[model samples]
Target chain A: MEPIVAYSLVLSAVLFTMGVLAVLARRNPIIMFMGIELMLNAANLAFIAFSRHLDKLDGQVIALIFMAVAAAEVAIGLAIIVSIYRYRRDVDVDAVNVLRG
Target chain B: MNVIELIVFIAAAALALVGAAGMVMSRNPVHSALFLIANFFALAVIFLLLSAPVLAALQVLVYAGAIMVLFLFIIFFFVQPGQKHLYVYSLPWQTFFSGILVIVLICILVLGLYMGGVFTAEEHVQSAAMKVEELTSPQALGSALFSRYLLPFELTSLLLLAAMLGAVVLARKEGRGDMEEKD
Candidate 1:
């Protein structure tokens, strides 16, 4: 096995784990969004690695789609965050407990 | 892998991990954003090394450049300087569960990759070299993206349009008279 593939996969896994941790541990919405970006980037890394390993263009194309989707997500997510901030003057996830039972 | 390749891989991996950890551990949102940018750049380097130059360029252009600037703008808009001291980890159980989850995920991924024979170093090196020869150039990527995946490509544009409209609607402020009339 190529050490590069192994190393990249391991790095992607670790980065994904960190993103999950950020989403779970952080109370701020923007930070959580950043976490999601990290996870997306991790997936992109894995995709590019596999694409190289298999000598395929499909993975790279899919990665391109993922980037587009991530960009859209950031746009909508930030807009929602800004709206929430306007309403409550805070972006803390715990504070926006309107959905809580 | 050659010594130079090994060294580069090690450096990129280390930088990526450090950036990720720094993003997660930083209390201030701005600092976390900066760390994430660092991670994005390091990941771009890895993409280049993987023989996907188009993806590397996109990673820097879109992820590191556009998305990060948007994040920073949102952070500045929503979070004032005095309000920067918000709770990062308000729950102890959250941290405990996150730790366990990280361990389980890493174990599963490492074991799965090993069992799948992905670490067969020589074969990987050979294939990787071949891939580098075939190197996914921007023109090739555009050809595949447009010809093979045309529908999804068009749909992504539609998705971007919707996202733009949604953002505008969500962020637009109504007239004060409208709120007073509703009240």
Candidate 2:
């Protein structure tokens, strides 16, 4: 509705596209995970914009919850990556595909 | 919509875009992590501009400070010589097609927003005129989190505990078990 909200939404979209690009093109699993984080940040940006527009605290609360989930996700994911790396010196996603059934 | 606010938004948006680009383009994973930190800081500024000061602070503290530090630590601890060049020098067919797909996705999303009349929609009518302070104060956020969102809040804590345990177990060496291997 407002110019600021519109601009922020557009920016969010752009950031999300970049994240998609990173995930698609990069070989490194960590970079792909970071791209996922970028996508989450874009969603949070949109949440904040809508929260301000509606004058509601619900969106901010949701964003906070999203942050907690993301942190937990990163922890478990990096652990998995670390363990995979220990068995097979390389950390490339393509090389780590021992589960291709 | 004042001049200063407009300028701040534009600058922050630019910073965020550059950071995103740098993160994607960097050859080294460490550089990408640093760029992501810059992007997170820019997003925090944008969050503040959106009147979410508490969320903005948390964004900086948790996302940029904590999560990225974890990323950097992993990169440093487990980096291999082969990973020095993370990005491919020449674009593969898949990468090229994916770039085209990204362009199409962005066009669709923006067009969908425009078609949904988001740009022309009127502001939501607030039951009471809210002061800027009341919008996203830490106290208000705390009340909402504790009252209406209590179950979800508690679930988040449980999730974090599980993740902590999972990380410890997953990262432990299999043969050595809990004890350190003697060199």
Best by lDDT: 2
lDDT tens digits, residues A1-101, model 2? 87888899999999999999999988788899999999999999999988987778888999999999999999999999899878777666766547631
lDDT for model 2? 0.89
Per-residue lDDT tens digits of candidate 2, residues B50-96? 99999999999999999999999999989964555342344458788
Candidate 1 segments whose C-alpha is farther than 4 A from its true place: A99-101, B84-89, B122-130, B176-183
- The positional error of residue B111 in candidate 2, measured at the CA in angstroms, is 0.7
Candidate 2 docking classification: medium
Writing each residue's lDDT as its tens digit, candidate 1 over B67-152 gives 99999988877787757534344665877887788788789988887898877756333444456766557888888888999999
Candidate 1 per-residue C-alpha lDDT over A9-86 given as tens digits, one digit per residue, 9 for 90 to 100: 878888988898888877777888899999999998898888876678988999999999999999999988888877
Q: What's the C-alpha lDDT at position B16 in model 1? A: 87
> Candidate 2, after superposition: displacement of residue B131 in Å?
4.5
